[model samples]
Target: MTATTTPLLGQMMDVPLLVSSLIAHAARHHGNAQIVSRRIEGDVHRYTYRECEVRSKQLAQALIALGVEPGERIGTLAWNGYRHLEAYFGVTGFGAVCHTINPRLFPEQIAWIVNHADDRYILFDITFAALVDALAPQCPQVRGWIALCDESHRPAMRTPVLCYETLLAAQNGEFDWPLLDERSASNLCYTSGTTGNPKGALYTHRSAVLHAYGASLPDAMGLSARDAMLPVVPMFHVNAWGLPHAGPLNGTKLVLPGKDLDGKSLYELMEAEGVTCSAGVPTVWLGLLAYMREAGVKFSTLKRTVIGGSACPPAMLRTYEDDYGVQVIHAWGMTEMSPLGTLAKLNWEQAQRPPEAQRALLEKQGRVIFGVDMKIVGDDGRELPWDGVAFGDLYVRGPWIIDRYFRQESGTPLVDGWFPTGDVATIDPDGFLHITDRSKDVIKSGGEWISSIELENIAVAHPAIAEAACIACAHPRWTERPLIVAVKKPGAQVTREELLAFFEGKVVKWWLPDDAVFVDELPHTATGKLQKLKLREQFRHHVLPSALEVGDKCPLEPLDSDKGAASGATANTKSAATRG
Candidate 1:
C-alpha cells in the first residue's frame, strides 16, 4: 500500500548567496574595519569597509554606464591593492564577471585569454600601461581600457584611456546590486598553462560563497576579526587563495602589500600593520628567512603563516616554529580546487605526539576539509585504501570543484563524477594526505614511480644546497632516472658525490638521486613553483656518468663535503638542517 503524507513548506527565506551581500554585510556590521593597501603610486592607501562599499557602488555604476551587461566579462590587470579588490566586488556586484588577469603570463597567452573571453573593458594598473598598450591592438573585442589610477598617474598612451578616479567620480547616484542567480558565473580564473593552453575555471556565486565559508572554518584558515591578516599571494590567482572574501566575512583586518614582496618590504609591512597571520609560497618564506638571518631581525607581531604553491621544507617549518614564535601551516591546493583543498593543522590527538613524531604528520599535505571529499585511485580507476603505504592518483569531488572547464567541448574533467587532481598522493588512516608529485612530474624509473618532490625536499635540507628541483632525465638502461637540479648556497662548496651521499639513509638506497648538477638559479612560475617542464627540456639528454660507473649497486667512495667546484655554506649544514 502506498503511504500518503503532507509535504509541509519550511518557513525559511530563500536568500541568494551573492558576493555583494558579503560586502553589504561588512559595510553594515564591520564598517569601521580597516583595509590598508600599499598603492602602486608608492603611497599607502587606507579606508574603512563603509567607505569601500560606497566606492564599490559608484564603481558599479561606472561599469554599468560603460555599457557592461549582466554576465559580461570585465578584466582587471592590477596587483593586490584596494582598487583591485574594488573591481572584484564592483564587477561581480553589478552582475558582470571579473576576470583577474595574471600579467606574468606570456604576451600571447594574455592576448588569447582576453580575446577568448571577449572582455568588454579592461582596467589596467599604471605600472602595466605599456603591457596593456601592447596587448590592446591584439584584442580588438575589448571595448576600451581604464587606467587604475588618478588622472595624474595615467601615462600618455597610444590608445584612449580613462582614469579610475575620474570614472568613479562621474557616477553620483547610489547603485543597487542586481538580484543575481547564485548559480551564475561570478568570476573567471585561468590555469597557468603549464602543459597546454590555459583553460578558464568558471566560479559561481554559490560556489564562491560556500568556498569562503569552508576556508574560514577553524579547521581551515581560521581567520578572525581580531587577527591582522596579510595575503602576500597575488589577487589574480585563485582569488588570492580566497583570502579577500574570507577577510570581510570574518572581519579580519587586511593588509595588502602591493608588488614589492621582498624581505625588507614584507617585514616592514608585517610589523607596521601588526600582521598576525600571512599566506604565501615556500619560496617567499625562503627569502624572508634569509633576510631575517642576515639582518638579525625578529618578527614582532607576525605569528602564523600559511605556506602553499609547493611543499614547505621541514627546515623552513622548524625555523618559523622553533627559532621564531611563528606557526607554519602547510597547505595544498590547485587553481582548480577554488585553490584550497587541505591545510596541515594538527588535531588534538596528533598535537599531543612528540615533536619528532609530529613532524611526520606535518610533512604531509593536510587532511581534506569538510565539504570536500578525496580518494586515491590506482591506474585502473579503482579506489585505494587509506593505508599510508599505497600512494595513488588523487581525486576530489565537492560543490566547488569544476564540473567542466569553460568553453571546452572536450569531455568533462571528472571521471565518474570525481575530479582527478593529477596528483600522486597517499592518505593515512587518520585522513592525512601526502602529495607525492604531479602526475606529469613523477619520475618513472624502471617500473616504479619516484616522487620528484620528495627527492628535492631531501636535497634542499642539505646546508650547502640553497634551492633544488628534481626531473626525470633519460637514462641508458633504466629508461629514466631522477636528476636533481640544484642551486648552491652563497660561499659554500659541495661536489656531486657529496651531494648524492648526503641522501644516504634518508631514502631508499635505490631512490637516491642519480646525479646532482649545480645551476645559478632554477626557473619558477609566477606563483613560486619550480618549472620542472623547462628543467626536463633543458636536461632531456642528461647522462648520469657518475651513477653509471657504480652499476646497479650504490656507489662506494663518498666524497668529502668541504670541497666542490661551485660555492656556498661556510659551515656544516648537516647539523643546522633538520636531519631525517
Candidate 2:
C-alpha cells in the first residue's frame, strides 16, 4: 500500500480532474446541499449540488465550443455568486487558466493586467459594465466577452459579447473534461503592486490541488461539511482563499453574498441561510461590527470567521469572540503560495488556556501547516532561531508553492529551493509565527530597526482612531524617522497632542510618532494593506529634531529675551527640553 509500490505516479491527478471527481461525489452524496446567491436585482437565487454539476458541465462544453484552448487565459471580473462559481470550475475545469481581475483596482492597472496576461475571454458581472466598456477597446487579445447576469440585468454592449446563461443553455451537458498534465498552469493572479507594477503568479494544477487539500486540513482551516460556509471575500482575490473548492469537497453549504456586501445585508443572509462559518478581511468585519452595534442585530448561527488580507487587530478579534460568541481566526498570505500560508487558530494546548491568554496567542500568526517548511534568515544569510525575540526575513518552500515566475524565469525571486516572502517575522518557542514588518516596510533609523506595522497597530488601538499607517521619512539627523498618518472615527475629535499622549505608556517614548497627520481616510492597496509609500512621499519634508540635536544647536539666551518669553518656554530652557 506504500506510495513507492503504487503505480502511475499516484494516478497523475490534475486540478480539473480533482474538481470533477469532487463534483460527482457531491452530486451523489450531498445532492441537496444548498448554494445561495444574493443577486443585485434584489432577488435571492438558490441551487443544489446536482444542479450545479449539470450547469457546470454545460459551461465547460460552452467554453470548448467557444474555442478556449487548453492553456488560454480566461478572465473573470465578477463578485461572489453562483454564476461566478460556475466560471471558477468551468474555466479551469476545461484546462484553461482563470485570471481573476480585481474590480477595485484602477482602470489602468486592470488594463495592464489583462493585456499582460494575454487574456482571450472575459466573463464579468453586470456591475462592471461601465468599467469593461471603457477597457474593452484597449484589450486587443480578448476575443469574447460574457456577462454573468441573466437577460433582465444584462446591459447592451457594442463589442462582441455573449450572455453567460445563454451560452450555458446552448450547450449540452455530455462533454467530458479533458485529461490534463498535473503540472500544467490552471490559474493566474497578479500581485497588488503597492510598490511596483504587478506581476502575474501563474499557478499550476498540481499547486492548486495541493493548496486546496492543505487549506481543508484541521490544523490549517479545519473546514468540514458540518460548517455552513460563506465567502464574503471577493472571488477576484486569491480564489476567495480557495474555499470555493474546499467547500464543495467537504460538502458544506455555501452562501454567496453577491453585490450586496454591506453589514446589514451580510448579517441578514447569514441568519437566513443558517451560515456557521464565514471569511473576509478586517475592514469588512469592522463595518459588520459597527452595523451590529448600531442596530442591535445578532447572528445566533454564526460560529466562526477567518480574517485575512491584512493583520487583524487584537481589539477586533476580541469584539467578535466576546460579544458575538464567534471565533475569529486570523490568517496571513499573499497572491502567491495559492494565497494561504499561515493561520492564527490555536493548537490543543493553547486552546486550553484562559480566554485572555488565548487571545494574546492568537494575535500572532499561527504555526506553519504540514507540507510547508519555514525559516527566518538575517542580512548575513544566516538562519535565525525560533526564540520569538529575534526578527528576520521569512522564507518558505512547499510542494504547492511557486518555484518561478511565469514567462520570466530569470526574474523570479526564488532563493535556493525556497521562495522569499518579503516579510520580516519571528517564530516563537511554541512554533507560532509573528510578522513584525514587511521587508521593505521596516524602518532603519540611527542603525536600529523600527516596525511600522507595530506602530500602526498601537496607534489604531486608540478609541478615536479609525485607521492608521506608519512610514519612514528621510530625516537629516537619524537618516530616517517614523511618520504616523491616521484617520479619525466619525464624529470623534482627537487632536495631535492627545493622540500622541495615547501612545505614551504603550510604546517607548522615542518610538512615538514624531508628528501626527490626520486625514479623512487612509489609502489602501487593492488587497487591503495600507499604502505607506504614498504617505511617506506626502510627508517627506516634515521632521522633528531630537533633544540632543536641539541642545547642541541652540545656546542659552537671556531670560528677558522676548522671543523665548512669547514661545511659552523660559529663555534658559530650550523647546526640546521643555517638551521632553
Candidate 3:
C-alpha cells in the first residue's frame, strides 16, 4: 500500500498577498488616517488614505495611458514626500516595478543605475529636473520624463517632460488594478555600489508583504494605529527600511520629511506631528542631539528609536536611554534581507538584568527575527559554536533573503543556500550577535586581528569626541596597525594622549591605535556608513612614531572608562546556546 497524504478538513481561501492589498486595507478600514508629507515647495501636504487610494488609481491610469506594462520598471527620482509615496503605490499597484533612484548618489552612479534598470518612465521631482536633463542623453531607454510637479513649477529640460498633475488629470477617474501573482516583483532598490558596480535587490509582493508583517509585530518594530511614525531614512534607501508599507498595514500615521532631513527640520516635524517612534542611523541622531542640546529641547513625544545602517555609539545610545527616557533598539541588516534580519529589543529576562548588563547586551546586534536565520562559519566551512568567543563569517537564510542579484549581475551570491554577509561577528549563548568588524575593515596587527568597529565605538564615547573612524595603516614591524581619524565637538578639544589613555584597558595594549589625528569631518557612504576604503588609501603610506615597535609599553597609562572596564566581555564570556 502507498503512503497516503493528509489534507485539511476545511477549505481555506487563497487570496494573493499583493502590495495593492495593503493600501486597500488602509483605505477601507482606516480611511480617515493621515499620511502627512513635508513637501519640497515649503508647505506640508496632507492626505487621507481614502484620498491616496483614489489618486493612486488615477496615477495608475496615467501609467497605463503612457503604455507602461506589467513587470516593466518605472523609475522615481524624488524625495520622501507625498508624490514619491503616490508613485510607489501607483507603479506597483498597476503591476509595474517601482525603482526608487537615490538622488544623493554621484551623477555617474545615478545614470548607471537608471540605465541598468531599463526604466521606461522616469518620474522626478522638480529638484531633480536639472539632473534628469543631464542624464537624459545617457538614459535613452527612458520613453518619457514625468516631472513630479504642476504646470506652474514645470521645468524646461532637454527631454520633453510631462507635468504630473496634468497627466493624472487627463486619466479617467478610476482604474482596475490587476490581480497580479504574489511572486511578481514590486520594488527594485540597488546597493550603494561602494566597492563595485551596484546590484539591485528586487523585492516581490509576497516577500514585501511578509517583511512588513514581520516588522509590525509586537516584538519587532511594534507599529500600530496609535503611533505616529517618522522615517528619516530615505525612501530610496532600502524602501525607507519598509516603514511605508508597515505603517499602512497597521494603520499607523506617517510623517514623511522631504529633502529636509536636517536637525532643525526633523525636530520641528517630529514635535508638530507628535511622532512616537522614529528610525534612522546614528549619524543622523548625532546631529539631532547636538541641535537639541544647543536649543535646550527634548523629545517630548518620541518614545523609541531604531538605529541601523551601522553600529551605534554607546554614548549616543546612553543619551537617548538615560537622558530622554527613550528606548533604543539596535537593528542590524543589509539590503539583501529586506533590511531587517535582527532587531536588538530587550527580552523579559534580559530586561530584568542591571543597566550595565543591558547596555552590554544592546551593544551587540539583537537576536534574529522569525523570518530569518543566521549561522557563523570558519574557513573550512565548518559551523562555529555560539559560545560568543569564536567569531566567524556571518551567513543568513530567510524567506526574503536574496538568492541572486537582479539581472544576474554577479550571479548567485549565495554559498550552499546561505547568503554570506561580509561582516565578522560572534553569537552569544543567549542568541545575541556582536558584529566585530567588516571582513575588509578588520585590521591584522602582529598576527592578531583587531576590530576597527569596536575601537571606533569606544573612541566616540569620550565627552569631547563627535565622530570617529579607525583605519588600518602601514607600520614598520606589524605590517598593519589601527589609525584613528576623529572629529571633535565644536568648541571642544582633547589631546591625543588624553584620548588614547581611555583605551588602555579596553583591549590588549596592541589593539589600541598608534596615534589619534583630528579632522574637521569624516567621509560617509550614501547610506551613512563611514567610507573607510578612501581613508585607507589616504593613509596607506603613513609613517608611525619611531619608538613604537611590535612590543612596547601600552600607548598611555590605563584610565577609567565603562567600556574599558567591561572591554572584551563579549569575547571572553563563553557559554552554551540553548538553541541548535
Q: Using Cα atoms with residue i matched to residue i, what is each candidate's TM-score against the true structure?
A: 0.93, 0.90, 0.93
Q: List the residue pairs that clash in candidate 3.
A: none
Question: Residue-wise lDDT of candidate 1 within 262-348, one digit each (tens)?
Answer: 998999999999999999999889999989989999999988899998999887888789998998989998878888899898999
The sequence of per-residue lDDT tens digits that candidate 2 reaches over residues 365-467 is 8877777889999999899999988899999988777777667877768888779999999999888888989887787777888878778888888898888
Clashing pairs in 2: none
lDDT of each: 0.85, 0.80, 0.85
Q: Give stretches of model 1 more than 4 Å off.
A: 1-9, 546-580
Clashing residue pair totals per candidate (backbone < 3 A): 5, 0, 0
lDDT of 1 at 52: 84
lDDT of 2: 0.80
lDDT of 1 at 324: 87
Please give the ranking of all candidate structures by TM-score, highest first, separated by commas.
1, 3, 2
Best by TM-score: 1
